[model samples]
Target: MAPHLADWRGRYVGSALAVVKPADTRQVAAVVRACAAANVPMVPQGGNTGLCGGATPLPDGRSVVINLSRMNRIRSVDAANNALIAEAGCTLAAVQQAADAENRLFPLSLASEGSCLVGGNLSTNAGGVQVLRYGNMRDLVLGVEVVLPDGRIWDGLRALRKDNTGYDLKQLFIGAEGTLGIVTAAVLKLFPRPRARATAWLAVPHPAVAVELLGFLRARCGERVTAFEIVGRAALELVLRHIPGARSPLAGDHGWCVLLELTDTLDAQALDAMLESAIAAALDTGLVTDTAIAASVAQAAALWALRENISEAQKIEGVSIKHDISVPVSRIPEFLERAHAELTAMWPGVRIVAFGHIGDGNLHYNLSKPDALDNAAFVSRTAEVNRVVHDLVASLQGSISAEHGLGQLKRDENARYKSDLELELMRAVKSAFDPRGLMNPGKVL
Candidate 1:
C-alpha cells in the first residue's frame, strides 16, 4: 500500500482506502463495478513511474487504487501483422523483449522502460527518445481494451492498420490520464529490427546549430535519423559529478552536446560510413564543433547512458523546479534564450539544466536550487517559476506538459492555459465517459 501510494520522484504522496491487484481484465472490471456501486472513487495505476503523479491515489484516503502489476502478460504476438497484444501490467521492457524474440522491434525506448508499464504509457500517451522516428504511444497503439467506468468491458482490440470505423473511441482514453476510464490492455505496433546503428556525441556552438545539424543529417541520411537529443553543459556536468564512472565522451569543455543516433537496415559498415560522412560535412561547415562517434555497440550504449542517466543524477543532486515543455522545433533556441533571461532576472543563482529531444521540440528545463537557498524556500517559489516558464510556453504555442500527463500537478495550470471552449469540450467528454465522476477524480479536468 505504501509503495503504491507514492510517485517515483517522491513529489507526490497519497493514501488509498485499499489497493487492489486484479489478475485479468475481468477482475479489473469487477473492481470497477464494486467501486462504482458504492459511489467511491477509483484510481487506476500501473508501474507508478509517472513523473506527473498520474497513477498515485488521492490523499483523501477514500479511493480504491486498482494496481495492475499482477496482470502482467503478453497475451499474443502477430508477427505477420506487426502487432502484439499486451496486458496493461506488462513492463515496457518485457514487451520490447517480446518483440525482439520475434525478430521485430517495438520502438518506444524510454529511460524508465524497465519499470514503466505499457498501460501507463498509453494512459499518458508517452513520448520517448525515438518519437522523432517512431512517434509516440498514440501513434504506436492500434487498439485498446478498456474497462469503462460502469464496470463493463469495452473490447476494441482490433489490430487493423486502417479502420475507417466511425469514432476512434480508444483515443478518448489515451492521454486522458485515467479520468475517463481504465485502459486494461493495448495492441501495440511493431517494426522491422534495424541491423545497424551509429551513435555519436557531438559538441555544438549553440542550440540553433544543433538544430541545423539535425536538418543536415536528415538530408544526408533521410529517415535513418532516429534520435537527436541536446544536453546543456550544466546537465552533462551533473551527470558526470553525480554518476560514478560517467566520463565525458569528448575531451574539450562544451556548452552544448548532442546525443545523436542513426539506425538503418543497411549493413554495419555502410551505416557507419553514412554517419561519418554526414558528420564530416557538418564539421567542414562549422555546424559541429567536435564529435565523438561511437566505434562499437558497447561504445554507443555508453554514450546513451550519459543521456539516460541525467534524471537519476539530478534526483541525487536535490529538488528542483522541473518543467517538461515543448516549443516548435525552430523556436527552441529563442525559447531557451528567453526562458533563461526571464528566470535569471526573477531569481539570481538559479541553475538551469535544460535538455531533451530537440528534434521533437521537447525540453526538460529544470531550475535547480541555488547553493545558498533552502529547499523549502526554493520549493515555495514553484508557482512563480511555473508562471515564468509556462507563460513562455504559451507564447510560443508550446505545451507545458509534453510527455508527462497532467495529473494533480498541472490540472489547474491546464485550465488556466486552455480556452474555455476547449476545457468545456474536455469536461463534456469526461462526463460522457465517467458521468458519476468515479474515475480518478481531480485529474485532467
Candidate 2:
C-alpha cells in the first residue's frame, strides 16, 4: 500500500483501506463489485509513474486501491492488422518489445517506458518524443476493455481499421484518468519497424528558429521527421551536473538545443542523405548554428540521454514547481519570450528549466528553486506563478495540461482555464458513465 498510495514524484501521498492486485479482467471486475456493493470508493492505479496525483488515492483512507500489476499479459498480436492486445499492467517497454518481436514499432517512447504501464499511458493520453509523427496514446489505441464503475465489464476490443458504428465509446476511457472506468486491456496500433534512423543534436538561435527548421525539414523530408524536441540551456546544465556521464552533444553554451530524429521503414542510406541535405541547407540559411549527427546507435542513445534524464536530474537537484504546458506551434516562440520576461520580472533569479516535444507544441516548463530560497517558500508562490503562466497560455489559446491529464496537480487550474459550459458538458459525460463516482474518485472530473 505504501507504494500504491503515492505518486512517482512524491508530490502526492495518500492512504487506502487496502491495496488489491487483480490477476485478470474477471478478478478486477470481482474486486470492483465488492467495493461497489459496500459503496466504497475505488482508486484504479497502474505503474504509479504518474506525475499528477490521478493514481494516488485520497488521504481519507476510506477507498480501496485496485493495483493492476499482476495482470501483465500481451493477449494477442495481429501482425497483419498492425495491432496487438495487451493487458493494462504490461509495462510500456514490454509492449514496445513485444511489438518489436513482431517486426513492428510501438512509437510511444518515454523516459519511464521501462516502468510505466500501458494502461496509465492510455489514461493520460501520453505524448512522447515521436508524437509529431506517430500521434499520442489516444491515436495509437484502437479499442479498450474497461471495467465500469459498477463492476460491469465493457469489452470493446476491436482490431478493425474502420469502426463507424455509433459512438466511439472507447475514447471516453482513454484519457479519462480512470475516473469513468478502469482500462484493463487495449488494442494498440503499431507501425512498420523503421529500417533507417537519423538522430541529431542542433544548436538553434531560438525556439522560433527551431520551429522554422521543423517546417523546412518537413517540406524536404516529409513524414520522416519523427521527433523534434527542445532543450533549454538550464535544463541541459542540470542534466550535466546531476546525471552521470551526461555531456553536451554540441560545443559551447547553447541557448536552446534541438534533438531531431528522422525514421523511415525502407532504406537507411536514403534517409541519412535526406537528413544530411536538410541539415546542410538549414546551416547555410543560419537556421541551425551547430550540429552533431549520431554516427552509431550507441551515439544516438547517448544524445537522447541528455534530453531524457532532465526530470531525474531536476529531482536530484531539489524540489521545483513543474508545469506540462502546450501552445500552438506558431506561438511557441512568443510564449517562451513572454513567459521568461514575465516570470523573471516577478521573481528575480528564478532558475527556469524548460524542455519537451516542441514539434507537437508541448513543453515541460519547470522552475527550480533559487539557491537563496527554501523549497517551502518557493512552493508557496506556486499559485501566483501559475496565474501568470496559465493566464498567458489562455490568451494564446494554449493548454495548461497538454499530455499529462488533469490529475489533482492541475484539477483547479483546468477548471480555471476551461469555460463553464465546457466543464458542464464534461461533467455530464462523467455523470453518464460514472454516476456513482466510485471509480478513481477525486480525479479529472
Candidate 1 regions off by >4 Å? 372-375
- The TM-scores of all predictions, comma-separated, are 0.99, 0.99
Give the alpha carbon lDDT tens digit for every residue of 60-168 in model 2: 9999999898989999999999999999999999999999999999999999999999899999999899999999998999999999988999999999889888999
Error of 1 at 293 (Å): 0.8
lDDT of each: 0.93, 0.92
- Sequence-dependent TM-score of model 2: 0.99
The stretch of ten residues in a row with the least summed lDDT in candidate 1 is 368-377
lDDT of 1 by residue, 1-445 (tens): 8999999999899998999999999999999999999999999999999998888887899899999999899999999999999999999999999999998999999999999999899999999999999998999999999999999999999998899969999998899988988999999999999999999999999999988998999999999999999999999999999998899999889999999999988999999999999999999999998999999888998899999999999899889889999899999999999999998887777899998999999999998675735655877889999999999999999999999999888999999899999999998998899898999998887
Per-candidate clash tally: 0, 0
Clashing pairs in 1: none
